[model samples]
Every structure is written in structure tokens, then in C-alpha cells.
Target: MKTPFALAAMTALLLPAALPARSAADPVFTAAAMRAHVEFLADDLLQGRDTGSEGHEIAARYVASQFDGLGLKPAGDAGGWLQRIAFQQTERTNIPAVLTLTGPAGDKSWTHGTDVIVGLNPDEPKVDLSAPLVFVGYGIENARMGLNDYAGLDVKGKIVVTLRGYPKGLPSEEGAHLSATKAKVAEAHGAVGMLSVATLQSMKARPWARMLTFANEPDFTWVDTDGQAHVDAPGIRAAASVNEPVVAALFAGAPQSIAAIRKQADKPGGKPRGFALKGSARIQVESVGKRVASPNVVGILPGSDPVLQREYVVLSAHLDHIGISEAKPDDKPDTDRINNGALDNAAGIATLLEVARAMALSPEKPRRSIIFLASTGEEKGLLGADYFARHPAVPVRQIVGNVDLDMPLLLYPFTDVIAFGANHSTLGPIVANAVAPMTIKLSPDPMPQEGIFVRSDHYMFVKQGVPAVFLATGFANGGEKAWGDFLGGAYHHPGDDMNQKIDWNAGARFAEANYRITRALADSDAAPLWYQADFFGDTFAPNAKKAAH
Candidate 1:
């Protein structure tokens, strides 16, 4: 039996041949061209392209200039290529915030960062919290999952200590929703403070040292039209992430052992229970805030069809990366301090630029307009993308689809690509068709446990009911070990610089696939639509109109 994907690929191949042939003189993606872009953007002179920093502004200007050189129309604020994103930055003071637990074994003080990492609510810069501690398994209140960690507990004015993640067996989206809303759920239940303990899974993914590396990094939130920073779980006065030993201390006199509770939480289909602890907690933190501006570079390529031109297909990539790290003595004598973010995202932006240039120079124009967006503050929790989604230059409804390029690790030769969120919408078949002629297999996410679908800039579009897909080089043709080595060694480290091994041809192939995907979305008669029974569709776009067939 021919699968729907196979049928779609056959139709795509036939239709492309029927359309007017593109000129041979049209600009094609080349490894050298892509390398030029990546090299410039990822250069150490850019100082890691930190959001709102001078280096980031320079990078933004470079992208804008590239758009101008390619003759793309400015599609950002005030007819400029830059859409300035207003942000509120919150920085914690260097003074150690304190966490003291008074239990059966007597009171114990935990040092900040060493014992627990504490952060005060931005709304309340200085908070002195003295409240009873309650153990709420995961602190989740998800009715859809038929589990409420706080259902039987009255946590009014108490500090809720919860595990980091959702239940083991729930669907990823469901778990993600529950986990994301845990803080708000706790606040709604009258909790005054929150203390999060890393789960076994989280601990394995990131060690304490890696987690503490960013302890001093500023937290950013998009400023609203009213100029107020967006706040989540407003009433929570204090929050802290405690180490494993601290978790043990918090449960010293509890009815059940912390080990037993963690065991239950780790088990499949396990539901850890909530209970009150025998003691109280004292939490304190101090923070300050400042307003800053970042730019999201946007440009538009008008389509040939007047009617279809009103609709748009968006190609997005984040342009920001973690900035220079403080100089520290390491075992490696030649360790680079700047996190150039070559593979983390400079590669993605380079690919976006190449795609834009190719589309601009192509003789055959797409039917729908294509928007090229190089967003900022993605490393700071997708702030720029979220802001743009909320306040778009065009109506959000007019965005037909999004193809996001982020961290396509071109570390080795690759025969396949992974398209996250491919299963959720018509975009699935479109992507299949796009990659079919390239002789590249579209593989499923090998690491579903990462919950990557909601972790990138495309997720902001998905939340706005736009059908979107995020592309990454897949683990095939000996790419798995390459990927593992990259993540384990250079993912966010200074080693992510251009000096690291990069397959330029692989990058060119990545850009080519993206270009094909974008062209298909822009030229297709029908817009992308969420699959009828998709969880995201049901939850986010229940009333979304179907695309014309």
C-alpha cells in the first residue's frame, strides 16, 4: 500500500515538472557561500552575539544589510529591517540568598549555588519568606491527565517543594503543559513560595556544574505594550532550585523517605503523593531590573500572485547565543572563552540567509510571500519569537506556515533529517515532498525524551495556531555518534566556535532542503493546516479554518 506521504511525494514531483522551469542562472546554495555567512556571524569579534549587546546589534545590522543587498523589502517596524524587541532584564545580586530548613534534626543553613540556587520574584526584589513547607509531588494541576499533585493539599501561605517534571507515562505535550504551568498552579493554590528539586532525568541531562554555570545570567521577559514586564505566577514571592542533598534535608522528618518518593516518581505510571513537612523554611533573595532593546531582523519577498501574496510563509532562525564566559582555569590550556554558537544557531542564521538569497534571485516566484525572520533572545527562553508572535507586523492569522531553522548540527555526513512537529500538521507531507528529491530520509525524532517540539522558536508560532516545523540534521549515516560528541563536548561550550570540525557540504544540503520546503509552502495552492486529531490543534487552534484542498 502506498502511504499518504509516498502519494504526496509523487504528486509533488509531477507538479514541479509541470510548472515553468527555473532558469539555470538562478542562484544556488553553495557550501562556500554558507561558510562565509557562518564564519562572519560566528567570528569571535562578534563576542558571542549576546542579545541586546553591541555584538548582537552588529550581527543584526549584518543580516539587515544582507537583506538589502538581496533586494528584499523591509518587513519590520517603521519600514526598517529591524523590529526592536523591548525587554526587561532581571539580575540577581551577588550576595548569597539564604535557605534555612528547620526540621527534626535541627536547623540547617544551605549556601547559595552550593546547596541551593535561589531566585526572588522579579515583582518583589527583596522577599523574606518564612513559611511551612509542603511536599507536592510534581506541583502539577492538569485535569486532562487525571492527576493533580496538589488536589488534596491546602498550601495556603506555605512553600511548596516539588519535583521538576511531570509523570513518566503521559504524552510529551501533556507532560510539558503540566510542567510549564506548575508554578502558576502552585501560586493559584495559595502557595507563597516554590522550591524545585531536579528529577533523575534532569540531573542526568545536565550536571550541577553545568546548571550553575548560568546562575548569574540575567533573566529576560518581553515588555508589554503598557511597558510592564510579563510575569508568570505573580504572587509567588520566592523560588529556589535545591541540590539533591538539600532535598534530602527538606524531607528529613517527613512521613516518607525522599528516596522512596523519588523511586515512585521515577517509575512508569507512578504518582507521588503530597504531604506537609515537619518544619518551616526561610528563603531570601535580592534582584534588580533594567529595560533593554533587541532587534529581530525581518524582510519580505513578494510573491507573483496578487491574492495569494496576502498570505505568508515564514522562515525563522534565532540569532542570539550565550556570550563570553568569565575566564577560568581549566584542564584544557587553550580553552576558548567565547561561546561563538556556530552550530547552536550561527549555522541556522547562515542557512536562513542563503535561503533568502536563493529565493530573491530565483526567476520563478512563489505564489505566497515569504518572510525571513532572524529573531533575537531565543537563548533567553525564546523571548523575541514570543514577542513577535504576540505583536506581529502582519496579522498572525495571515501566517500560513513556518519553517524554523535552528541548530542543524552539520558535524558529519548525514543521509536523513529530523523535522520536529512533522506529525502534527499538513506540513508533514510538505516536508516529505521537499526532501524526497534530495534523497534524504525524513526521520522521526530519535530523542523524543528531549521534548524539543516546544523548546524552540517555532513553538511560539505553534502557540499562535500557525502550523510549523523545526528542521535538524538527523542521526543517520554515522551521524549519531557525531551528534553525541558535539552535544557532549561543544553544545554550549566555547568549543562551539568555527575552529570545531564542520562539514560545509552538509550545511549546504541543509540549506537546500530548507529552501525547497519554503518554496513549496509559498507556492502551494493550499495553506498548511493542523492534522484534524493533533493534540496541539485541539488545544491551541480548535477553531482554526481548514486549508483549501
Candidate 2:
């Protein structure tokens, strides 16, 4: 167990008299009731709470019960506390996947699990297609950014050879979003498939061998009411990432050399132009899948104000984790294989529960209604939260703001916090004021290149035109080293159990910070609005009211 910070007593500042006082030996974490929640949720018996598993169902029931005990109204389906979601989980069936390129020189082929690896296709069980190839730099088409890789190119009824990542030197979050959804642009142009050849930079980050290992992981997408799986660009029949050899072949005898394209992509503000290649590509793969179901626990705390009560501020935390590893006789007898995910997010859920308790016990009710959500399938590409955002328990337009709690590192005393996406909306000052009284500062995004803004549950809400922020303990005071150490070792591993060094006082402080932020959003006179002319605001909610930056 890690020792509490020197200023551990400051935990009492959280909710400021929300819970009973605790002795010096027993801190506010226990008094605030997070310790019990964390211990139970992160216990070995929960089996890591894998999405759609029995363990996860148990975890969901526990969260529902906690909400029920708080006297909160059920906000889920059919007057119940569970918003059930169906998913289509898929994995490759070890078929001999193959990709062929026919060019001026000759026909060249590469087998999967080696020079190429195809991603799982949730829409098709088996795919066989051949289409002409076109090289599109970064495959990003955004008119607002004044840089469209497909500006002068037509990929209709053909396969497009694209770079793996976004161009250099765009706004980190906006660039990341454009790059991530590049497939949709390809579909819009009637492209039949995507042929992604990694840049030298991307290959350095994820080498061929490492990419091969990750390619084996299963893929998931939520199912619609019609029993069809969701795909961002369903029109794109297939996509495959190729290595150096395939990249060379894709650009052979082209107007622009691959080496020059690589050089341009290696530097800042690289914009390699797109062109038609000499040849066509054929892609083939087989996918095996099964239908699975999970639930998002939803509870409503009614607002006191008659008018504002119709509006809502959502507080969400993901409850599922990576599952356990299979036991092998070759494994060491002392080896513990369960990935309990104590900090990977059992801690976040615990904090959410405590925040709920603090709100329920507080004498004053919020002006706007509050929804406390324990979402499942977050580890599976934010599936649960995405489902909820698209199909909310309440009207999606009624959600004015969202504060998502994901992976708060309670390893050290954080002197500051980071609210991702705060700068894009009026929520910035609200977050700032909430933590100021606790002697905590608000910091800017320290690692912008990681594109963390679009990688959490709140991003799902943001896409639905809701102003949202993902709150996490910042890298300050011993937090930098603590974050690095945990990420390098325990993150997503068996070492993330309760056995690790977890400072309860830090957890309490983190919970309090989120509580204050939620209370402020719910009580504020005006709903959170995107800053004027913001990219996300214009793109997602173009006609909505906006705030001055």
C-alpha cells in the first residue's frame, strides 16, 4: 500500500461536509464509501468484468443496486436500471488471407499474418474483390481544414492506397478525428476498399512484427435493432495494411516516388499528393462472429428547478475490463493471471459511485437533472458509450453536458487535473472553478500527440453535439513518474489488482474534484455550449448556439 500524500488530510475538502468525519487513521475514502466499492468491483471473483460476460453482468447489477439504494430513479429501458445493448463480436478464423497486386511488371501476392494483415470485417463473413488502385495521401478529406487529400482525386469503384496516420501540423484533436474517420471519406467517393500502407514514421512506432501480434486481437461493433452490425463506412468492402514491400509495389512507376512521399510525411505539415497507380488490388478474408449483449447502468437524480429539470448533465464511467488469461501448465505456479484493472478503471467506477453517494446525501439538489452511467464495453472501442449516445435513455438533445471518468491514476497526490476537450467549450471555466478551492490547478493537454481527446467515453457524447469533458488526475507532483510507471508495467496487465500501491486519499480527492465539477455544471444558469467557431461545434452541431471563446 502506498502512503498518502503529505496533504492527505485535504480529502475532507471534497464535498465539504457531505460525509461523516473520519479519524486520522481512517481517511475520507473509507468514509466517502469508495473503498468498499473499489474492493468489490476489482475483486478476483469479478473475473475482470469482461464485456458481455457473466462477471460483467454481476458488476452491472452491483452498480444498479447501488443506484437503487441511493433512491435514484431508473433511467434505463422499460423503467429499469439497465440499458441493454447488443454487440457483434468478430475474430478471424485462421483462413489463408491473401492480397494480390497486378501491375506493369507482373502479378505479386502476399499472404496474411506476414507482409499484410487484414482487419476484421463485421459486415461480411467472407470478402472477395478486385479494384483499381489510387494513392491518396493520408486519405483525409476535410474542407474546413483547407486540406483535402482527395480534392482532385476520384476513387469511384476502385481501391485507394492511403497512408496510416494524419498529416503533420494540424490541430491535434481535429487532425486525429479526420484521420481516424478517413474511411468515411473513401466511402463517400464510392471507393470499394482501403489499402493502407504505413508511413516510415508509423512503421517505426508499430513495426511489422508488433503489428502482426496486434492483428490477432478480436474486433467488435454494436448491433442495430435490425440485427445488423455497425460499420462507419459500410460501403468500403475491405481494408488491409501492407508493409514496405507492398508499399513499393503500390507506387511503382507512379508520378510521385514512394521515397519522396515518405520524406514529406516524415516532417511537420507533410501533405503528399494523391495519384492513380498503374495496377489493381484484390483482397480476400474470412471473419467469424457471435452476438453478445451487455448493459449500461443508468440512474436519474431529479433536479429541483422546474424548467431546468428537463435538461441533463451526465456523469459516466466504464465498468468493463480486459478478461483473464487462460491457465497453462507451463505457467509458473505463483503467477496471477487475472487482470483486475483496479486503476484501469475499477477505481473510476468507485469514484463515480462515491460521487453519487455524495450527491444523494447533499442537502441541496441540482438545478438540472443528473444521469449517473456505469457503461460497459468501453474497452471494446467505446462501444457501450457510443450505443448510449446514439440511443440515450433520455432524449439525446436534452443532455447539455457530460463528464466522463476514465482511468484516474490514484497513485499520487495530484496538484492539478486535466480536463480533455474543456478548451473547446464553456466547460473550461467551470472545470477551473470547481477544483480551485481544493488547491488544485487545471493544466493543458500535456501529451497532445496521443489524441486522448477522442479516445474516451465523453468523445461519444461530444459526437452527439453535447459539450463534454474527460477528467483525469494530471501529471504533477509525483504524478508524471507515477503515470509512466503504471502505464509501462501494470496498465491492462495482471499487476493492476488491489495488491498494487493505491493511495485512498488521492482517490478521495479525485472523486471530490469530479463531484464539484458535476455540481457546478448542473447548477449553472446556462447549459454548456461549444466555443464559437470550434471545429467540433461547427461539424457536429452547426446550427446550435455557441459561446465566445
User: Lowest-lDDT window of 10 residues in candidate 1?
Assistant: 327-336
Q: What TM-score does prediction 2 earn?
A: 0.93
Q: Can you give the lDDT of residue 549 in candidate 1?
A: 28
lDDT of 1 by residue, 1-549 (tens): 667998888998899889868669545678898899989999999999999899999999999999999999998889999999888888888767899998888888886778688875657777789999999998887665688888789899999999887889887755775688787999899999999987777788777887787777777888888987887888788888888778888988789988888888888877889999989999977888888999999999998999999999999999999888877765476666889999889999999999998899888888999999999999999889998888887899999899899999988889999999988888988998988988998998788777888899999999899999899999999889988898889988889988887999999999999988998999898998987766787678989965432
Looking at model 2, which ten-residue stretch has the lowest summed lDDT? 23-32
The per-model lDDT (C-alpha) reads: 0.88, 0.89
Cα lDDT tens digits, model 2, 22-96, are: 544321335236667888988989899999888899999999999999999998889999999999989888677
Candidate whose TM-score is highest: 2
lDDT of 1 at 521: 95
Instruction: Report the backbone clash tally of model 2.
Output: 0
